[model samples]
Target chain A: MEEFEPKIVAFCCHFCAYSAADLAGSMRLQYAPNIRIVEMPCSGTIDHRVLLKALEDGADGVFVAGCMEGDCHFLKGNYRAKRRVSHVKDLLRAIGLEPERLEMYNLSAAMGPRFAEIANEMTARVKGLGPSPFRKQTGGDA
Target chain B: MIVAEQKPLAEIAGMIGDCRKVLFAGCAGCVTVCLSGGEKETEVMATALRMKRQLEGNPLETVTYTATRQCDPEYVDAMADVVKGVDAVVSLACGVGPQYLAARYPDLWVIPAQNTTFAGGSKEHGVWEEFCGLCGQCVLHLTGGICPVIRCSKSILNGPCGGSQYGKCEIGKDVECAWHLIYERLKRLDRLDLMRQYREPKDWSKARDGGPRKVTREDVMIG
Candidate 1:
């Protein structure tokens, strides 16, 4: 049987993580290719619904990457992102999904190596967790 | 404003178990301002419920509608057509909204998604503090805009009980001494003399003790 390749969604802040991913490619860094990245103007733009939708859509894991603390170009975008990430994590756990399926990280735009490291780190974590339980059981009735 | 929190998803899920048709109702009043049950929140709840049901092998047919004010009879009446054939309604409004729906539509099962906490105002983003006790009286003018009844832990009428320390209440560091706030405002308004006058004991009969009180306006009465 083929190994379970978990579908992962990464919400990357344009100012930092997205640029970092670009830098990773420019630097010829090797990272897991299973994750699909969505670029947002700021990490704060990531809503709880987006994370929930990703899980509902059968993604094994989701994460938001923002600028380092106090380094957001929008001043407190990263702070808002942090609050949203925690909220979604709580919501997911309430529905029997492991909170570990969601993650929040902060890094600089120049950290190409760090972006690659995160990709590998999250991929390994999801592989160990198996598939999302939501992939099968719908909430109430059909 | 009113501050409320969402009920646990598991508890809410149980209420609508095996129900294919569902109504997700939102209130534009207190729940909306508190960021708990607004139009946007209704959409989110509808999506969450639908997705959850899909995961549980029970796909749901969900419909969402937010009223201008769920506490009003007219808005709830407007939902008559929308409620037809729906198995149950999950109200995202505050405590009043669900009761109103249940009262108006006795045949339809109404479930509350929010646990109403208290009458409060936003302290900051995602933070709210109780301000009005709804004691059936407004004495904000006497206190120089600071509410001693609600903000003060002890609900001291005259002044602080000498337990205030460093602008904080003696009972706990979290609670701010309401009298201190009143004193500062009076001093700034040059109405320090107002605080000197003694006040009589509050009339509890006019508050919660009144037992579902009601007021009528003669001028607005129909002949």
Candidate 2:
């Protein structure tokens, strides 16, 4: 049997998580290659539709990475993203999709190791859940 | 504004059952302001329904559109071309939206995705309470801006009923007694004299009991 490689899309705030990914690369940290990071001005910019669009477009899993609570450069952008992510998770569960497929993480730009850890963690979680039912049923290109 | 809530996911999914393609219509009016149905909510419902049907081994194709106001003929007419191609339409507006769409496109199946709850406004973020009953009569002036028609459990016009206990209604602990609210408001404004005036029974003909109603203004009518 061929090994399953999950497709994960991570929306990272440019102020924090995105910079952390760059630092991870410079440090030569090992992480899952399945992650595709899309940088946003702030995680708050990621609307529920954008998150669902990623899944609809074939992503097996999705997550938003932002600054720690009360530490957002925009004062409350990360908090807003957190609430939106939670709402999307409920919507996914209602649709019969596993809520675990979506998540939100808080971290600072200096946490290169933590960035790699999250990438690996999310990849492992999605792999265990297997391919998204969307891809399996629709033969969607993700 | 009209306050509404989305129907449960199971109920909505059942309504659209066995359909291959459907149009999800949203209203950018009162429903939007109340967070029940709008462009954002329309997309959310579309995505949810698509995934749900996909899971059932019956994939669904959804096209989404938000009219400026579904109650208006002009806004509903704007979807004529889109409605022509779909098997059904799921309207996420107040009750009026689905009715308007159904009247406009009699050939298409029109389903309501929300339950029209009341005529009210947001009391706070994510919280809404019933305010007006649309009785076609204005009595706020006598009631100190508190509406007994909606807030009171019995819709009493005279005074608090025997069921009022400790400023709360007998219907629910969370419900504040409307008469109590009126009393406090009137006392604060030094308008206690207004309460002494006996109000006659409301005219039922002005409300829904009169059957379907319409308003035509001679000045505004144009050929």
Candidate 3:
């Protein structure tokens, strides 16, 4: 049987995580291929509904990558994103989903290697959790 | 504003037991500002319910609608067409919202998705504090706009009692003694004399004591 390669969606902030991803690409950093990046205006704009929709639409794992704490381009955007991410985590847990399936990461534009590391880390974590129960039920895209 | 919070998803999900489809009705009134019920919340809740049921392999279907004010019949009436064919209506408004829905739709099973907490406003972003007990009486003038009936731990009309310490209620350090706030506020206004006026025992009949209260404004009635 082919082992489960979990599908991961990363909501990346343009100011930081998006730039970091670009840098990682420039540096030719190799990471897990299962992760898809959705560049957001700011992580603060990542809505709770959008995050849940990602999971419900069949993504095995979701993460919001924002600027470092107290270092958001919009001053408190990252802080807001952090609170929202935590709230969504609670929502995920309330629905019997493994809360670990979602995460919030803080990275700077300079953190190319860190971006690659996060992709690999998230991929491995989701792989460990296996295809999400939603995926297993519907045989959704892995 | 009436402040409220969403009930746990598990509890909400439990309310619809075995129902394959449901309509989530959200209010754009107080519950909206408090972020418990609104268009977005309605969508989010419906999505959550669908996903939960999907995971269980039952796959619940959902319809979403946001009323301008669920407490008002006109808005509740707006849910009329949308409520058809659904096994239940999950009202995301405050407690009053579900009651109104139930009253509007006889035979429709209406469930409340939020726990209506208090008559209050936001303290800050994401924080709401109860400020009024809705005792059906106004005492804000005497209390210097600080409601002793609700904010005071004992609801003492003439208080601060001996339980007040360092401006905090005996109940908790975080609870500001409502009477203390009243005293300070009145003192600042140079009306400390009002504090000693010897408030008579409040008339209980004017409040909830006589059962559910109503104000019939005859002037607003149309022939």
Candidate 4:
């Protein structure tokens, strides 16, 4: 049987993480293909519900990749995203979910290597955790 | 407007524990202004529920919808499509919205996300207090705009009770003595005589004690 590969959703900031992924493509950086990228004008546009929908849709893990601290193209966008991510973590934990499933990272658009690095890191972390129980195949539906 | 406070998250989570397909219904009315329920909150709750279910190995199906005013029938009717296949409806409006939903959708299980508090205004950002006691009597003008009925811990109409000291109430030092506020305002207006006027004891019969209140404006009636 093939080992379960975790599905991960990455919200990439248009100004940074998205561009960094593009840069990674140009650099031919080999990384895990398990991560799906959703491009947003800014991390601030990543609402709490979107994150929840991804998890409900069976994503094993979620991440927000935004500009480095104090460097958001839309000033303070990353900061706002950080706060929202933390709040979501609390809400998740309160509901019996591992807060670690949701994460926020700050990096510049030029950091292609970092993007691959995080992609590899998250994929491994999720793999160790096994498949998401929410997946339709897991018999998790009530 | 009807005001409300968000129900504790733990409590809400427990209520929806067995639900799979759920509709998070939020009201864009008083609860929205108070930050208890709104479009953003509706989404937040749906996400939380989804994540929780996934973690528990009992994944849930959740959707979010916001009504213009859940207390209104027409607005609530808009949720028909969203609630179509859901097993339950979690309402984020005040006390009125859940009752309205339950009444309209007798077949659907309805739950409340907020605890109806009172008819009040936000004293400041994120802080709300009871302002109108719904006494059915307007006495604010006589008290220099400070409502003694709701602000005063004792609801004393004559003046500040002996418990007042240094401009605070005895019930709690942090509480600003409502009558002290009245006195200061009256003094500023140089209307000290207003406090000297003897007022009769309140008639509770005409207030909320009379049962569910009703107000009819003849001129405003279409018929």
Q: Could you arrange the candidates by lDDT from highest to lowest?
A: 2, 3, 1, 4
Give the residue spans of candidate 1 off by over 4 A: A136-142, B17-21, B46-61, B162-166, B217-223
Q: Write down the lDDT of every candidate, Cα atoms only.
A: 0.87, 0.91, 0.89, 0.87
Q: On a 0 to 1 TM-score scale, where does candidate 3 land against the true structure?
A: 0.96
| Deviation from native of the Cα of residue B129 in model 1, angstroms | 1.2
What TM-score does the first chain of candidate 3 have? Answer: 0.95
Each model's iRMS = 2.3, 1.1, 1.1, 2.1
Q: For candidate 4, list the clashing residue pairs, or say none.
A: none
Deviation in Å, model 4, residue B138 alpha carbon: 2.8
Question: Which pairs of residues have clashing backbones in candidate 3?
Answer: none
lDDT of 2 by residue, B1-223 (tens): 9999999888999998978899999999999999889999999899888988888889999999999999999999999988978889999999999999989998989999999999988888889999998888878999999999888988899988899889999999999999999999999999999998898999878888888778879998778
| Top candidate, metric TM-score | 3
For model 3, how does the per-residue alpha-carbon lDDT over B57-93 read when each residue is reduced to its tens digit? 7889999999999988888887779999999999999
All candidates in order of TM-score, best leading: 3, 2, 1, 4
Q: After superposition, how far is residue A84 of candidate 4 from its true place, in Å?
A: 2.0
* TM-score, one value per model: 0.88, 0.93, 0.96, 0.77
Error of 4 at B168 (Å): 5.0
How would you encode candidate 1's per-residue C-alpha lDDT over A1-142 as one tens digit per residue? Answer: 8686777889999999999999999999999987799999999888877888788777888999999999999999999999989987877666657889899999999999999999999999999998776654443211
What lDDT is reached at residue A115 by model 2? 100
